[model samples]
Target: MKKETLFIAFSTQKGGMGKTALTVLMASQLHYTKGYHIGIVDCDYPQHSIGEMRKRDTDLVMKDEYFKLQAYRQFSTLGIKAYPIKECTADKAIDMAEELMQTSDKDFDIIFFDLPGTLNSPGVILTLASMDYVFTPVSADRVVLESTLQYATMLNDNLIVPQKGNLKGLYLFWNMVDGREKTPLYKAYEKVIAELRLNMLKTILPDSKRFRREVSDQRKSVFRSTLLPADKTLLKGSNIEELANEICQTIKLENHGNQ
Candidate 1:
């Protein structure tokens, strides 16, 4: 039997919301730490940041002794190579993913798409509609919140409620939360979101520069990488593990096994 693969995306109408970073982090965590086979379709068109990151990660692993040793140990022990990242336009993303699933030697549990940030991009709506689950990152900013709410409302009204596509759930989660921010602001937004009846994730990611770091020769431990799972030490207090756990539970994904 062909493996059943979940199509998921971390997306938002607004840009610089950490969608790409979250995608790579979650994919890495689930694939390496949780032993789930993974694939990534980089559909951000002109940028293809995830695909580029993969190239840079590969280079770093080759040049850096620490990263090289880590990669060797990981692959040697797991008996699996790094997950594949395919690049394509928004319109061709689904087709590319399907082809990848059919052709890949390993059975994938999930295939993530890093989509274009703007809705004006060709096939953005179509791609978003096709996901089994869509997770949007929101912040405390007024403009970001407004844009996200409008975009979420549009998806809820047009695709989700009408059952137009494969979308099973649309989730919004707080991202880039600062400890210094007033509590009342978050409470107010939570009340508003509740009134709007949108699904919100319980896990909120705190603002940290670590999210921007990937496989680099300068860093002693990796926080984010396309080839390796995050270092266990860095996961403490990061809440990324919590977010991953919640997402897996929400999606009804079985643990399968872990390395």
Candidate 2:
């Protein structure tokens, strides 16, 4: 049998939902912690945030001796390879994924796509529909909630239900959660979840100043930053380990059933 690769996308029709951050966090955790071979496709047209961040990361690693040393140690110790970030337009995304899976020397075991935060982007639908799973980050705010629900409904109507097996799963996870204590927004989120019957992941990431400022200035992720290890951080910290584990288990279960 041919090798199997898990294709996942962090996408939504709404912006400012931390889609790129979540994608980087999950990819970092899986690659550094779980030792999975992975690559990211930055498909957000006009503004490839992940690709830009990767470039910044590379520049930092090369420019700073301390970061270079620490990064080398981290990668060598974990036996993890540097994965490529491919900049793809929406029209070429599916083809790019196929090429990566079939021909890329890395032979990535998992591929993550950071798609445009809109529905009208060219080939967005085609690219998203080809993925094995699409996870949308949703906030408790009313505008975000409404857009997320509408986006999910659109996917279901246009691709999932109508095409049957085109998209394996569509998942939603609460992002930027406030705290452990139940708040009004939390309650509203619960109500929305019930109303839309959202298939939400159990792992919810908390709001953190670190995540908010990570991309532009620091260009580092909390989970897999060369500047800081997993143990050290000022922010509330990321729960990406739990999220990664849950996703892995789910994927395994799905693959087993398919067999």
Candidate 3:
């Protein structure tokens, strides 16, 4: 495992499924709590959701007490930053990514790629294989899950991830999960979970209005207690952050052991 470079590509071959939200949340969590020097290469330029997200984040920090209040009066203390990577050609993307990895600041610990959703995009295949891990966020619906499963299948058919000394699988996780009781949507989610447990992480990000509200106005995750309460129903767990910790620890394990 590359200690400092846990690169994750958040893509689902489908749009409006909370891919941006999950990527931003994971990046923020890594930066704020675990202290990872993180970089987001927003491949979706012109429609740069991640870059605009960073702006919203800075804006939120200026107005809200959600983020850490630095001793300095300026609200520029948050370290999360984003840059727009050019077109989706595999060679160009791979080269740019490698250069960023090597030349990044000493504090940089993780890198995230916000890839465009379409698999037919010029460089998506290479981008998918290049990642050490992947977080594919699918909503609890059939069309969303079907589109996501296809990407997993595509990645599996072509990529060989070197984990430890052996090849391993890519990690997958469900996002925008609605805690419905045995509904059709829930059943659909269950099917994918059974098929990809090895690739899946156990933590679930429940669907919540807070996620939408913050994304619209605040433009960051609602993880910290200052922005959201520990037991906030919007997050919908015993504790709001309880599931988030599950994801970090699960990914930090020695290996997935399935592949």
Candidate 4:
């Protein structure tokens, strides 16, 4: 029998670090390419990017035909069948997770939870405890990596360790990186990562217009667009899809070690 793996939550104590984007990217990957049964729990209420993007991600999807093919033509072929849940407490979130487990997700191989960027949320601790791993996205800035480190400390200090499971560092990756000369922020961050010796992902998403346009103008992807201004001004650089692909590889390789 195939063992059940419930979910993994992507979180960071700070905002503007690409948490939602990565969460959506991973869900897209697991469903479209890897052929895993997947579900997404969008805990970012009111203005949930995951839900908003899901509602409008079709344009971008069409642009990136490869990923689009993975999503296929089905309505919600990504396999995420639930609507966004609004709650702050761990008890509430866990209760929702338990309820979801009773539904059609019995065959699901993975579930992705897109969490809001807040430490005080009621589900923060419970969500962290329930996950197989928490993938934190960090920017190439001293402040962002420092904030990431601080949250790691909080997980160590505040969270009640689950007797039957454990959470481990998945490493921080630099997102929205510009391919120009290293900014002072990058230099400062290097020293901090060296001192803490925190694990960092090998992939770095270069700062590019494609990402900005995809988010800003509601374009589905950098590769797919008809607007001349958006096409010319928005996607002028190397694609970041490759970096997201590495994240997929990391997810597979990491889980491979468990078996």
Candidate 5:
């Protein structure tokens, strides 16, 4: 029997939303920590960061003895695969996704898209509309929150609502949340969240140097990194685990055993 594959994208209309990093983080956590078969489709056009990161990761594992051992234990026995990144035009996104989702016993159970952060790109609308779910990460900045809400509304009105229950959905989650107490920005966000009735996720990723220090000029996600001090290590691991679990529950994917 052909297994079902889940197609999801970490996307937003505005740039600087950490969409690419989120994709890599989610893919790594779900595959390495949670034992799911995962792959990434790098469709970020001119600069395919995730694709480049995959190459860098492969090289580090091969050449650096310490990195290799750490990565090997983290990955353990499950296979983690990444398809070659493509410079796919928006017009070709659907075809490319369909090609990637051809399921078999050895195929990926989940495939993530690292899309360019714009709707103007060719086929972007069509490609985004075709996803099983689109997960948009937004910060507390007024401009970003407003734009994200507008984009979410557009997706529902244009793609999901009119499709007569094709079951596609859009989700919003807070990214880069700071540790400060109830600030005006967060209060404003809560107001909008309630007003829009958006499918807000429960996982809020706190602002941390772990995300920045590890991701900068490197291919290692925190999910596969072994160099963190004890405190940051525990915090990062907890956050990643909670976020991964929330995602799986939201998407209704069974925690298939170590495949």
Candidate 6:
């Protein structure tokens, strides 16, 4: 039987919601920890943040003895190199991914797209419409919440309802949660979201400076890297692991990890 691959994206209209960070984190976690094959399409063109980060990670791993040794040990143990990250425009993202699937030596279990922040960009909507699932990272802020709800509603109503594309599910997850903030605010948002009939992941990621930390010679262990899975110790309390598991289960992905 032919293997099935799911195309997913972490997207939202507004920036600074940890979309790219979560994309890398989840891809790394699922690939390294859960033993899944993952690929990333950096469709957030121009900056291509994920692609640039992969380049910087390559440089740091080459120069830093700690990261270099870590990479070597991981590859030797896993018997696989780091997952691939491809860069392209939004419009060509689907075609690019299909090409990768055909050309790659190993079959990918999931292909994630890191998309541009604005929907106004050409092909952004098309790219999103093609995804099997789109998980939007949202916060408790008023402006961000409003924008996210509107964006999700538009997609749900226009593309999803009309069955225009391959999109199967649209989910919203709470990211960067500040414990100090009042609980009532979140409850209110939950009420509104429930009334709006939006699907939400049960896992809520906490606000942590670690999310901003990337591969560096100065650090002993990496928190985020396109080439390396996050250190298990660093992942504690971040809820990233839970989030990954939740997404996989929600998508009903069969666990095909080599482990």
Among all candidates shown, the one with the greatest TM-score? 6
Task: Report clash pairs, candidate 2.
Answer: none
In terms of lDDT, which candidate is strongest?
6
Residues 71-183 of candidate 1: C-alpha lDDT, one tens digit per residue: 89988976757999999999999999999998987778899999999999999999988999999999999999999999998998899999999999999999999989998
Model 3, runs deviating above 4 Å = 1-4, 59-91, 161-168, 183-198, 215-244, 253-259
Please list the residue runs of candidate 1 whose C-alpha ends up more than 4 Å from where it truly belongs after superposition. Answer: none
Q: After best superposition, candidate 2 residue 256: deviation in angstroms?
A: 14
Which candidate do you rate higher for TM-score, 1 or 4? 1
Give the lowest summed-lDDT range of ten residues in model 2: 226-235
How many backbone clashes are present in model 6? 0
Q: What lDDT score is found at residue 120 in candidate 4?
A: 75
| Candidate 6 structure quality by residue, lDDT tens digits, 1-259 | 6679999999999899989999999999999888999999999988999999999999999998888888999999777689999999999999999999999988889999999999988899999989999999999999999999999999898878889999998999999999899988898999999998899999999999999999887768888998888888999999999999899999998988876
- How many residue pairs clash (N, CA or C atoms closer than 3 angstroms) in each of the candidate models, in the order given? 0, 0, 0, 7, 3, 0
What candidate 2 gets wrong by more than 4 Å, as runs, is 180-188, 213-237, 253-259
What lDDT tens digits, residue by residue, belong to model 5 across residues 1-259? 6567787898899887778877777776666556677766777887877666666667666787666665566445444433334446557666676775654346566878877788888767877876888898888878888899999888878888888333378888888887784667676787787787678887888876566444223444344322211233644534756777888888889766364
Q: Listing every candidate in turn, what is its Cα RMSD in Å to the true structure after a full C-alpha superposition?
A: 1.2, 4.1, 6.3, 6.5, 3.8, 0.9
Q: lDDT score, residue 232, model 6? A: 86
Model 4 CA lDDT for position 230: 24
Q: Which stretches of candidate 6 lie over 4 Å from their true place?
A: none
Q: Summarize candidate 4's per-residue lDDT along 13-100 as a digit string, tens digits.
A: 8887767766655554445444555566777765766555655555655676654654454335434333223333443555666566
Sorted on lDDT, best first, the list reads 6, 1, 2, 5, 4, 3
Better of 2 and 6 by lDDT: 6
State which candidate, 4 or 6, has the greater TM-score: 6
Candidate 5's TM-score reads: 0.84
